[model samples]
Target: MLEAQSRHGRTVLTTLCVLALLACNRPPEIQHDAVFGPSHGAVGDTLWFSARALDPDGDSVGVRVAWGADDTSGWTGFDVPGKLESLSYVWHDDGYRIVTAQARDIRGALSNWSLGRGVSIGVAPVRPEPPIGPGYVQLDREYAFRAVSRDTSGHERRLRYVFDWGRGKLDTAAVSYPSGDTVIHRHTWRTPGTYEVRVKAITDRVGIPSAWSEPRRVLVDSALGSLIWQYVLGAEVHSSPALDEERGLLYVGCDDFRLYAVTTAGGPVWQFVTSGRVRTTPAVAPDGAVVFGSDDETLYCVGPDGLLRWRHGLADKPGPAPALGPGGAVAIGDESGRIHVRAPDAGEWRSYRTGGRVRCGPAFGADGTVYAGSDDRLLYALTPACSLLWSYPATGRIRGSPAIGAGGTVHFGCDDGAFYAVAPDGGFRWRYKAGGDINCSPAIGADGTVYVGSDDRWFYALDSSGRVRWRFKSDGRIKSSPALGDNGEILFGADGGSFCVLNGWGDLMWDYDAGNDIQTGPVVGSDSTVYLAGTDGRLHALRTGCRLATDAPWPMYRHDARRSARAGGPH
Candidate 1:
């Protein structure tokens, strides 16, 4: 019974082996399905193929991929039973192609090919070129500029061009590509200087459509060679220099107890000895006479030739720069707390007293009113007849001249670190807190921006509404009043002995080093020259790139009797 059972088991085993051999003898079956993603694509688009294959005989299967047009990644290694695969191809040329796949079993048996999705390629877009434009502009005047760029891509797109004016100003414009490569732009420079102008092209699809072309230098206003001439004096100069356009002479006072007349070429024209140091800026009269006060308790009037025309003794030392009013009337103040007015034709004068020393000079209004500040912490408004019209009290002593605004407002700074803008009727309009002592007069721009410097070492620009527009820091205290250039540059000096020029937006354009502290203000001549006095007793001359005014001149501390601090004309 055991033998019979063994034989039957052997028979069964043989039968199973025969069946297994028969299956192995049969060729492995291969079946695969594949699909290409993004059925349609551009010339540069990458296409993806996903494929699945099976071996009916339970043998390993491999995938062979073929991208039509000879684009193929060949066969993949075999796996057990079935295979899942993915392939990618980028269309380099513009055309249509079909992706297909086949499968092979471990027995080297091949199957029919399975078709994949079709893909199409189109032409790609081309990048545009750099922009081209002109490279020259005049200071303070607008110039028409044009820039050109083009797109090479056959497809239409929008292109943008950016113009870097190189003076803290920029502009952007967009146009239709292919047809639009040229654009017209206009700009005005507020200061005279050299700057580089360039443009870049861009598109929504491509970043920086083209590289920025080489920059072209634009020359502003002055073409004078870069030469700064200085005239050395015997003592420190705390006075602003006066310019004589007719003879190209500069008049300034020195702590050496003398007033000097210097040629614009930095040559000494002459000197007039005073009893004491002169700390006041010389005021030029309509008749070409220069008037200034000295700590010697006297005010000296000198002719354009540096000859002393007259001298008036004051009751106390005069610290304020003299002002010339309409009809040649001269107004000044002294430590005695008195504001003195002299008749245009004679030395006869009248005085108005304040509670504190009068170290600040008086400014005239368009309506014939006089505005002055006092150490007594008050700002006084007086009629041309010397009668007090009104007085506005401040928290600190006022040591600077009052500036009249176009709207009849009076602006001044005080020792209390405050700047006040009062109405013409002596009513408070607004007050701005400063970082430190506010002892400098404010200058008004044509656009109603106010400029003043502080002992805090900052120069501030305030709008007509009393809001700070911008502030620039200096190395030291800035007691010097800010002067406006014809082209909108702000000029001032610092106790650090540096003189700086700032644009209308409070950007520093340039600066010069003076050997000593500069407590004096700066002035722009009609010929666009700059005049500055240094505590080192030297007067420096520089180019301002402004046009000279033949109609009037900067005759006093704040330029005009109005003390608006606005130079040139109504602007």
Candidate 2:
């Protein structure tokens, strides 16, 4: 009985030993080079890596991936042994990094790490520099902006740019450019307001975006008329004002026998005294010279500093403002029925005698051909050399200056109460008769709409074909020419000191009573300020919050704020 009991105990001990051996866990095993992932990546990139492992006891296993010493993915969900497990990790820094992986079984036993995979993490492009562009722009005008950036990854990569136009608008380039290259983009603002523009760069391949650049603030004006300030001169300002945009100065002739140079801000800069009434509008040359005709029977040229540069004597008192042509040529008409023209860099004055006094400023065609009106009832086209090109006879004397429109059509009003459109080659396009003499020059709009004023006290808007579109009645006879605002608003003055603003549909926007007749038309500045000359002896600067319609061929009297009298150029 003792021997049998001893054998049973040995058997039980042996069974217990076998059960303990079975319960002991063996850690999951991974191949020495089983970890795999991309060899290169950019910062902030989410990279995937796969690792395979096997458990000796056929237990489920989980994988853990470490992108760096500080970045790690905690254990993943358990899966079957010998399965390839994929885990994702993001690197915040740039440089060479080693990725590693390990495995664990359900029994909580960890295995040795697999061979590390070498990944060369790249850096994204640097933030772009602040956009470079104009500080002030007219509303609805397209402007250009530039952005630049560089990549520090030491790799030849392309970068794309994105622009934020501050108006909750964003634009991305259609294609990428080389790193450190400048990217140009254009944007237009429809509304008037201050806007901040910003930009950013991104790697084209990895799509890693850099920080945004510093913002550039831009001011946009509506350019519609509101009173900013008014400067009263010594006498009536029948002469239109000229703007020297580069110097921020305005030059205008006053009946007080003085040529005034005022700042655009309404402060008096300087005034040049004349011997006779200075009734002609001033013209600015590219070299910062101001030229105008005075009843003193002299055409004077003054420097930007208000000093007289030179003066040329005329046959008789100059009746209208001088027109500046290409290369500093000056053309003016005198009461002696002579049109005097001086060539650039020449000392001699060339003259062409008309049958009657030349009372209006001459307009220039694209090729430098000059168009002038005479009291003899003729519209004469002359060459820059003062030789007649062609003459279109009118029923009565032509008093107003002529305006050139698209396709070289010349528009002018007649003392016989008729408005005519003459073709470029001296052929008549059409004629529209008014109830009274049409004495104001025509302003051509972008769509070929012609705006003019008549002695009948009416402001007329006609289509390109000389058909009346609409007409607005004024308090007195209309004589002042029309100027166009950027938003298609028309501005004109009349005999009763009335300056009115009208929209494209002929509805009145507003009006200002200058207390005296406004014979000269209004001039618009880049900031949309309107400079109106009134017989009240004041130059009114109205902040219309509207810009000039640069697209219009003839937006104002004598062409532009400088009274250039040249066609096919910027307003």
User: Number of the top candidate by TM-score?
Assistant: 1
Q: lDDT of each structure?
A: 0.71, 0.84
- Output the number of the lDDT-best candidate: 2
State the lDDT of candidate 1 residue by residue for 51-131, as single tens digits.
Answer: 777777777777767878876787777776555577777767655677787778777777777756676554433322332
Which consecutive 10 residues in model 2 have the weakest lDDT in total?
1-10
- Writing each residue's lDDT as its tens digit, candidate 2 over 277-338 gives 99988888878899998898999999999999999999998966788887677789999999
Clash count per candidate: 2, 11
User: In candidate 1, which residue pairs clash?
Assistant: 43-122, 526-548
* TM-score for predicted model 2 compared with the true structure: 0.62
